[model samples]
Target: MTPDAILALYEWVIGACFRCGDANLFVTPIDAVVTPRGERYPLAACGGCVLDMEEERRRFAERKGEKYHPGRLGRPPA
Candidate 1:
């Protein structure tokens, strides 16, 4: 997916997760607004007790870290 598409999906996911009380399922702290190419999203965790699924979240976290983390993007880490 293009960055814009991914960002849009991420926002939708965040909204759905929040509405479903699954906010913890996300790894990055995402805003409804589109993040710049290098902005970092907050790290999120799973809302359920399933530990095995954390790997997926970790993957997202890694991607977010690489793309949005300080030094990777022009902005400093929050």
Candidate 2:
């Protein structure tokens, strides 16, 4: 590939987070979002974003009278 194309690919990967678009944040592959028009897009999210999403899930579970078990999404030691 050309130098410009390579650089563009690098930049795209660096900003691959579907939610925050923060290159510095570590990411995990999450589920995809399906639009009403039947388009599906994959997602990856940072730790903070995952925590926020978990919190929302917890709230919804409580509202529905269900138990919420948190997952192990933290980064392990190198």
Best by lDDT: 2
Give the clashing residue pairs of candidate 1, or none.
24-45, 26-44, 27-43, 27-44, 28-42, 29-41, 29-42
Candidate 2 overall lDDT versus native: 0.58
lDDT of 1 by residue, 1-78 (tens): 343333333222232232234542443332343368766544332233123233344466797785322111212346
Measured against the true structure, the TM-scores of the candidates, in listed sequence, are: 0.21, 0.56
Computed on alpha carbons, the lDDT of every model, listed in order, comes to 0.35, 0.58
Q: Please, what are the lDDT tens digits per residue for candidate 2 over residues 1-78?
A: 333332232212223566677775556666677999999887777655666766786798799998865553332322
Stretch of 10 with least lDDT, candidate 2: 6-15
TM value for model 2: 0.56
lDDT of 1 at 64: 77
- Candidate 1 lDDT trough over 10 residues, lowest sum: 67-76
Using TM-score, give the best candidate's number: 2
